[model samples]
Target: MMLTIALPTGRVFSDAVEMIAGAGLPCDGLASPGRKLVIEAGEFRYILAKPSDVPLYVSYGTADLAFAGGDVLLESAMPVVELLDTGAGRCSVVVAGPRSQAERFRGHASELMGLKVATKYPRIADGHFSARGVQVDIIHLHGSIELAPKLGLSDCILDIVQTGSTLRANSLEVLEHVCDVSLRLVASRKSTALRWKEVQSVMNKISSHVKEKRP
Candidate 1:
């Protein structure tokens, strides 16, 4: 059976290319294709989409399998099956702000009610604060989340920080660690039922490689 897979096209892209090749599913076309979104390797069909959109492709059954971040999966709440944790692109979703307001958030997040927060993950941010019995005015921003508190657009921000350098450059400090994010292998239920053995074979191959890479 021909298996369709969706992958994001950024940080996880190169790593995925390498991982898939190591797993005996060499996508030579994907590795070398220029200006092409779709690449086919024998019975495997691969589509490159934005990281956030990969889950959507899998959820809609447009792609049989997908590699997505736990952060995006939580924010989007797509109902696709999270089959395995790949552990690539490890990072944390965090609440941050300029050092000026550091003391305030450090005490009690809920006390700062109506806090102005900026984030790309509104759902995640809302859920985090709501659980603490706090309400916030969430400012939705696609990028440069570190600048929100710098420019007075918000008191704090919720964003994924792979390294603290960006926050330091922006004079922000992490107030709380929301959750750790990593790539995970996901499969559509239709794909699981229709091509169970094929999917298992690929998953098994990759799973073994993942175990080898981890300490």
Candidate 2:
């Protein structure tokens, strides 16, 4: 039986491929897939997709297993089994704004009600603010989230930050840290139930490698 795995195709693609190859899976052309979206390696078939789309592929059974960021998984809210934390794509989901707005957020947070918050992860942003009993308008943008505050499109932004360099470069500062994110292994329900043995075998190998690499 063949196991179809979905690999995110962006910053963490190389890391995912390295982890799979380290787990003894063939990764001949994964590092430089170029235009090829699919690659077959013996019993394992790989599907390269956007990081945000991996969860959808696994949820719809297009791929049995996948690696996705915890933030993506949270925003997607797809019904898939989270198997393990691959410890890849480490970052933080944060709420940030310009220095002036940061001052208001810190000193008079209540007065900033209905402040516009821009982000790509609307679901995650909404949940975070809602949980905090704060109500703000969520402006969903596909890209260029940093520009929102500069253009006055939003007073703040709830997005992912890896090194704090982007925020610094944009003259923005983190007002709150929402959550830390990392790549996670997830599996479709159908695959987990029907291909239990195969899924378990692959999971065990990857899990072993994860443990070995952990410090």
Candidate 3:
């Protein structure tokens, strides 16, 4: 019985794999030198995918489980059962902009004059500013949202701030923290029902490992 897990491919991949290994799961495949997107370790088949696609894979039952950031869930809005907060890949969805614009935010309604905001997470950005009763012209970009403010494409950027280095380097400051993000283990409803014991065991191992790392 093989359990397929979707592993995000990128900087977070190594961290996520290490956490899985620490949970007593075989994760040797993650270290193999190859371009292979799929690898087998113990009873699990790990599939490397973009973080955004992990939830889709799990929701569609192509992968039984996955670990993704809470921000991804908010952006993708895929239906998946969140099993645990793995406490890895911590960051925040934040509204940021150039020094002047950041200060103008929420200070006066006058700043709303065709206010521009750039972000890859448009839905998240839209909902955030809307909830605050701030009307903004959200410019959607696939990457380099920080560049938007610097290039004058937008007044600010809504993006994931991991270390705040990107914002600082780009001469931007965080105006508001929309939400905190961390890696979360998710399983499809079908997987939960069909592999109840397996899923439960994996969840327990992961939960215990996370608890052990707590201060």
TM-score of each: 0.96, 0.96, 0.94
RMSD of each: 1.2, 1.2, 1.5
lDDT winner, 2 or 3 = 2
- In model 1, the runs with Cα more than 4 Å from the true position are none
Candidate 1 overall lDDT versus native: 0.88
lDDT tens digits by residue: candidate 3, 132-165: 7778898989988888888889988889998999
**Model 2 segments beyond 4 Å from truth?**
107-109
Error of 2 at 164 (Å): 0.6
The candidate, 2 or 3, that scores higher on TM-score is: 2
- Model 2 lDDT per residue over 1-215, tens place: 67899998888888888889999987778778889999987887899999889999999999999988899899999999999998888999999999887667676557667989999999998899888777889999999899999999999999999999999999999998999999999999999999989889888999999999989
lDDT-better candidate, 1 vs 2 = 2
Worst 10 residues of 2 by lDDT: 102-111
Candidates' C-alpha lDDT: 0.88, 0.90, 0.87
Error of 1 at 209 (Å): 1.0
Q: Compared to the true structure, candidate 3 yields what TM-score?
A: 0.94
